[model samples]
Target: MRRDSVLQIQHSFTGPDQGTKGTLYLVPTPIGNLEDMTFRAVNTLKTVDVILAEDTRNTQKLLNHFDITTGQMSYHQHNSQSRIPQIIEMLEAGQNIAQVSDAGMPAISDPGFELVQAAIAANLTVVPLPGANAALTGLIASGLSTDQFAFIGFLPRKKSEKKAFLDNLVNFPYTMMFYESPFRLGQTLEDCQSAFGPDRQVVVVRELTKKFEEITRGSLADLVAHFDENKTIKGEICFYIAGNDDPSTDESLLQAALDDMPIKEQVQWWETHESMSTKDAIKQVAKQTGINKREVYAKYHEI
Candidate 1:
């Protein structure tokens, strides 16, 4: 390395916020409770020339409470492409900006990573401030092994894709965290029950750090039963589950396969693998699951 170039790389003392190039501060807002907002985060947002919010209305209420009169511009997934160049131009013009999500950290199941990468590519300073995160909040209290864990924000909505995604994580040997909507909570739980088995434990953290926050722990079977009766649950759910340590038994493997597949496919499995006739497969399914053959027949007809 050249001696003069080596000197330029050393002894950089100025904070990221102070630079000839305008900085993009990735500030984290409170996930639920307003008190969770950090002092530094609020100060950074106040000092920046403009705030780029996932939703202007939601961020406006938060800024009002803090009495931060900083201006905010809408920057979400739909408009990210056009806005990135505009933001970059502002940064190049030495206009400091702070990017924030509706809740929690920016870019975690939210839109901000693209802008951050753009800033980096343009040699602009990017600063990140830590505050609240739903995944970590649920993990610390999940009572599961958190020494090494994976954060899978949200699964694919399609049944086929969701099953494939969960199948890939079935044998992950650490705790797993996921964020899911309350509307699809039951079906998502059923998918998890399929992948992790009925005996695996799960912890559900709802509306973390909020007034009506709730935390429930139980086996996969227990949760499936609880959610089945309460189909109209509300609030965001932080799902934590224990990963597999050993290979699944034959019975559980068969159940997992059945769990992911439609009834028609299961009937075909019975016909092909168990050497049963079509009528025999239907009869066996009804007898084994206690679900009437009429309903099973209806599903295939619909398909």
Candidate 2:
């Protein structure tokens, strides 16, 4: 659709409160389909004095679609720091403003947390609007255990840092979720295999809510093989790694390994000899030493 057609819609929204101008509205934009925009969110954007957008051009399309011409300013990762003070000042001045990311909810591994934090510190009212989210959608459709899960967002791009992050999370008892771009999906699955073990169960959800949506479930080893053989992968990918189901490891043996070498070294020894999850091995060490498993994972992962 032409950009002007969307803007035409933005120019038509009305009934925004001109009084009580200091409230901060957190509006969630659609992750994929533009039709997902909620009615209340649309009205809020239309009524607010200003809209803080991660990408003004993208938001402009939404505003134009809804005929919402409320003033808008760019508030993204690069500019948010400098812009935050101004926004706070405006809010304190009683000028209501709305903040939005390009997709999904803002401040969710996105760049709006500081603004929300500042607003709370300054005693301003903050409102959250429910909307589309890739993580939750992927989790639900992934067919992986989701009663409890951790959203790790995007993993580090650096090989060492990413591996360490994965290694440290092996002991997490809850299911885990991570975002991965198609470009790096293969490497990410390989790293998960190394950190969580090849036999660990995982589900990959891609292109959610789009025409090509797909959900793949299998062991990490199977995924690694699929990605390795495929020439290319497309769309955003969410990785859900199932927690280890084996009973906790033996503490005395884990401690013996830890006492003589480093934690990662110990985990490697136990994993190689006892065939245990790195998390289980760490738990065993923590059980013997009366230390936290988290600390053990950190020490071993060295992150």
Candidate 3:
């Protein structure tokens, strides 16, 4: 077994030693605009022995734009497992390496986590440089609460699964941010409306930092209608939803309590407490319990 060094404390300003293992730099690339790239990031890339790019083809454009001549090795999701050991060996051999995703920060819903973990376990120093992040960029301008927020990356693809996944977070009190594709924007909005209710505030930011950047803010229902009418949503998206502030009326808790009741009783509970119509109440019950809507409807109507 290879014996690793004890946990070595890192100080950002501590200069590298010729005898020590090389540092792993987690550099953030611009999400859209190239100007967002930091001076330090550029210098680091220039100085590093090599770069581990998520997509060599995509990163080549950025490197070309910046006139960076560093060689790159592909390190993405498909190849991370195989690449990690090799990367650690490179670091061990005192070859400084910088890891960059195609855009934004490394390891935040990107390919850097496994590599970072491996580097740390091997007791090598890991350094991070701050740069563009779609979620943070959207949140500051979103007009939503930023004091506390959760970064929920891409969600489940299927409609029922998506709804069920969101249903679990309905009562989360901190602001929530998510990344989504343009193709599924409409259905995602619909699912948000069902899970979080129509009145909840939301902000949708598209094509951020680009010429066609747009930030739309309104209630869930309002944005749902707006996007539905437009029908041609495009660009990278980062969306924010207001969190549940009313713990007294925490719906998830209420639903959990209702779990003890019969299906008919659950439907009735939503109607009486939420002032929902019979059909709407039945749908709500079905969504919460993962029961088939038809089964819930039949149970509600049974004598």
How many residue pairs clash in all the candidates, one count each? 0, 13, 0
Give the poorly placed runs of model 1, Cα more than 4 Å off. 1-18, 248-303
Rank the candidate models, highest lDDT first. 3, 1, 2
* lDDT per residue (tens digit) for residues 1-303 in model 3: 999767567664564643478989999999899999999999999999999999999999999999999999999999999999999999999899999998999999976998888887877888999899989999999999999999998999877889889998887999999999998888899999999999999999999999999999999999999999998988999999999897435567777799999999999988998899999999999999999999999999993
lDDT of 1 at 26: 90
For residue 259, give model 3's deviation from the true position in Å: 14
lDDT of 2 by residue, 159-208 (tens): 99998888787777888888888999988898899988889899989888
- Candidate number achieving the greatest TM-score relative to the actual structure: 3
The lDDT of model 2 is 0.82
Error of 3 at 269 (Å): 12
Q: Ten consecutive residues with minimal summed lDDT in candidate 2?
A: 6-15
lDDT of each: 0.87, 0.82, 0.91
Residue-level lDDT for 163 in candidate 2: 83
